[model samples]
Target: MMYDCNLKIYQTLNVQSEFNIGLLLLYIIEGSSNISINGKTNMYKSNDMIVINDLDHYRILSSKKSVIACLFLSRVELDKFFRFNKKYYINKDKLDLSVLKFYMNKLIVNYVNDQSENEKQNKILEYINQLVMTLHLYRKLDGTIISNNIDVYSGINYMYEHYKEKLYIGKVATQCLLSVRRFSNKLEEVTGMRFNELLRNIRLSYSAFDLMYTKKLISQIANDNGFTNESGFITHFRDKYHITPAKFRKQLENDHYYPFHNKNTTLLRSFEHINDQIKYLTDRDVDYVSIDINMKNKIRSKISTPNLLIYIRDIETLTNNFQQSKLLSMRREIGLFGLLFSHQLFYELYQSNFENNKLVHQMFSFSLEHQFDISFEVKLGKNQNIEEFTLIFKRLLNYLTDCTYFYGQRSFQFYIDASYYQFNRISKIIQDNLKESKVILVLNKQNNYLAKRMSHKVNDNKQIACKVHHEIDSDKDITSILKNNPSLNILYQPNIPNRIESLISIFKWSIAFNQNISMIIDDTWLDSMIPSQSTHLMIKELQLNKESHYQLFELILTLKRLRGDIVYFNGLILMTHYLNEYQIIIFPNMKIFNRLHQRININGFKLGEIEYRHHDILIKNNQLIINSDGDTHQNMAEVSFKREIGKLIVQFYTSPYAIKHIYIKQKIN
Candidate 1:
């Protein structure tokens, strides 16, 4: 209940994928990750404090000999904890050098050495007592005292704010109207470090984080963080850590796998993907849904209380296919859906049951559409407090969703048919946050009333969008449109052979210069429209990772859908990557137009409307040109680079993994 100064094992083994509430993990060391409180399976490394909240699954990725000080309990349980012990929780200010480390190590030792129930319970209680004290102190210090006396805390906040920049102590001292020596002495007395040394420490800490958290070049990190030179930063970093930055990172990775660091890493996140990391948490008879889309095989597998991936194109029966996985578990509730499981289609039982529960696998395939439902409850193996965990789980999901999509991080995209309604709602929210920021809207065709309404919100204080489409009559039309609807501007967009040209047209009219666009997908295919190359750029904009295949796929497919293609008729690129398990054909550009034809009219979808006839596409002189085979060249990387007929040509590039050796060598040393 009350966060004791100790650690407790909530669950000893792996568990189900469900969310939790009021769970926070404190990091003992520096870690890697851009944690958004919204999604599952985000990467996290050592020493990152994470707050777990709501979600469809739990967050339990890899846990090393990681000693984590977790605060978990219902509000009622926490009240009881506080009632029993008051001094256990600590304030951040009171968390000084020896005591924090001492308690941390104690929790680690206790959890490892003692398997006895009584010992575990005793230590858990002790840990909780100490933690409550720390939390209470943190609140009193952070919430009440700081707000009341802003001036006293302002200096500390200011230091933290600009610490990442190339901090000039001389300038800072001047601002405080003190002599160099006086400022130096005062700062050291206040924060316990010499000014320059403090600056160095801050820079080094940032550098260390950049090394672990980002894949940026060393030079880039040094330059961005205001280090004079990479070598200078390297020297200081080595002096501080007794190892090179590279070596330190190598050590971090090793420490995670082997016992090296004195601290442990805990990822505080929503409980959605927790099951993947944990091996023992089981499912309650509660109902839940598992959505699995496998592109390689173009299959959507289903399992009730099932956590397995299914690729629908498999020759084996769903039951036979998952037969092996069943042996790994003694208890499981499994079911199948789709055309692959047609034999069991007529069996109209509400739910099927197996005596000795083992593996769970389900499949279904419908020509037009395939739908199924599953419900299950993920339980924290340590205890059975469903209501409490659910609250945390839900909160965590909110954070994750923000991290996954809404953030300025290259997390979303702009599309031909992004909703004006969604855009307007998002605009209101953004306007509240950035009053002076500019907004842009690019419509494919619906550029009349909706664009006019959204444009009115834009002004000198907050610039509006430059609307564009192919229907305007001459330069006057573009000018007239913007004048009449001062809230918006108009640009020309022609349905032509050149997509790049069209995009260039849109970019040219953007008043924000580099204002990032958030493209909401078509109403019918929202999830399907979330993936694309444009989405990749959005991820870049948001500075988020492109590691999530599902996110990437979703983004790209959404782009395809916007392009009006048959999205799920066949397998997608990812489905192809997953291989013969799914069927994937059709170019993205073609897919869009065809889908539009299919949906908008009865006699649409005729041939000769697409760029790629086959799968191989061509890229020459930075322009996309079609080849005879549709996209036959899609899989072929530029084999070589050369000049042919005075044109800079792609004589060679690379096939997948072909240049991996060169890439790795360059990446390594």
Candidate 2:
């Protein structure tokens, strides 16, 4: 029979039925029905769409005069479109039911009109495609159903029931009446994971559910879940979940946790929308050339002029000459102080034939004319050939040196790894060629090459910025790193950029110590590959709440609005007071999740009259209090002036990972 032949419309019905297999789509066009799929029952009314996947045991109880449209596709047919290797259940509630209803109506109309089989099948296929795209299918990690082989089915069921116990594949094979090798092959083929991996995943699923819904300690959860040790559990969890169990639990505690997907769904889906923003930011045609200089200037005028270097690690895109408009748009959207390229990429471009050289020259010329500082980071592997490396490095340096003559002695920054054998030689080259620019040596905590050792080698007239890697997990680590290295100017390389606590702590420390920090805008910041990650500032392209449109935009604006030096920073909170204005950022401490209900009090501010604006902060009776209840996304107040009287003490309670920005100013008398 034709594909469309499987769809049938019932005008009147009084029946209870079960469907053993195939994919089924039912739309209630006229009346309501009580439907139960796989033990759960719900009343589906008119305009409602329901999707039943393969092997679903569904029963339908309908009233007389009820109109229902049913479209069924067999397993053979569904396999042609989707991979049945893994079981998929549609997230019916998460989808836009209206869109599915519209397509369902179209299919029903086409079938009722006695349309040609070709046209009918095409419509059916169209509806199926929409269903697939709109309904983000939830894939279960608890092994695929093996209906054909009773032994395999029994084995899988046994595995599920005893997943918490220490399982050996040989014993499982014996229970299934099969050889060990046969069972292993069958399990891998059906579940896409090996014996140990599959068992661990099954345990993880239960542990994650408990983590989200229960208040059990990490060690207790790990022990109960059959993990050999808490550390092993954490390692496996991070590998699969992309974060520590504590942080994962902490993120769920946040009021902003949307629970947008299934419990089995990874936390990564919450921020998966960020991929769209990244795609938009990076979209470009390779053949497109740069716009005229006047056009570039006009584009800059249309938006807030951004001034921050964008770290681009993908060098091939640059060499391929991906549209300069995309780069310009990035600069327009997020201020690009300049473009930093990997030294290896520059070397490759330098060594390429004359045509590649022209491309490089064109890129540098455009960047220089646009007031973008071009910089490079040279990372040397211990096994690198020094002779070849230096040769290419010098050539790239020569090109930058030449650009300076044209761009009027522009300053250029070079970040050389401490591992480089000729660190001093490279520093000397930068010092002699670019007097105003800086050469920062990147060092880890264990590096024996202290600032003092390097300080004596360089001239006193030359300034060397000390940059150390910030890796340890506590405030004490930051204190020790700074106290021991007084000249440390930059927190060179920070890991786990997505963790809001880590980012906030780094920013707080930088502001407190009057030091500058940097971010490497690479995949770690842009990519959301796992479920256990927290939300960061993501740009929404469409019209959202215009008042709080682009969060990253607001963050950059806040950074620009700081009046003077940051006066107070205690990791969780930061304050900057200068002239007539004060800027303070308050956020909950993730370590002490219990203290979230408590209030924070700050005093000692002299003011004749107060003009204050705040975002997600409650200020009442000279205390900064939490909103008790607020929207998921934090809000931002437009810059305004107002009058207030009484003590300046501020007390506030905050939600997990919710960073609030408040601005207070004294009215000029």
| Candidate 1 regions with alpha-carbon error over 4 angstroms | 1-24, 27-145, 148-166, 173-190, 213-220, 256-669
Residue-pair clashes per candidate? 130, 12
Most accurate candidate by lDDT: 2
Supply candidate 2's per-residue lDDT for 341. 76
Off by over 4 Å in 2: 1-308, 315-336, 354-356, 456-481, 491-497, 511-514, 523-560, 590-606, 616-646, 649-653, 667-669
Best by TM-score: 2
- Candidate 2 lDDT over residue span 1-669, tens digit each: 223234566544333444333467887766788889777999988768888765456767777545666766543344435444334444454444444554565555555444575676676666555454434334333344434665765676577668778889988899999999998887766555688886786677567666755789999999888898999999998877767788877765232222111232122212232334324322310111111111111111111111344565554334443344445555654554467776656556656763355666666777788787766777776677767777777666666777778888568777776553566677777677667777776664434345545545444333334443343433455455555554555533444333333444555565545555564444222222111122342233222222222333345445545555455544455566666776776664332121233223333445677767776522221123233243322222232332223335444445443456778777776
Residue 478 shift from truth in candidate 1, angstroms: 24
lDDT of 1 by residue, 255-359 (tens): 322111122333332333333323221111111111223223322321011012121222232345232232112112222311211112212211333212232
Provide the overall lDDT of each model, using Cα atoms, as 2-decimal numbers.
Answer: 0.35, 0.54
RMSD (CA, Å), each prediction: 30.0, 21.5
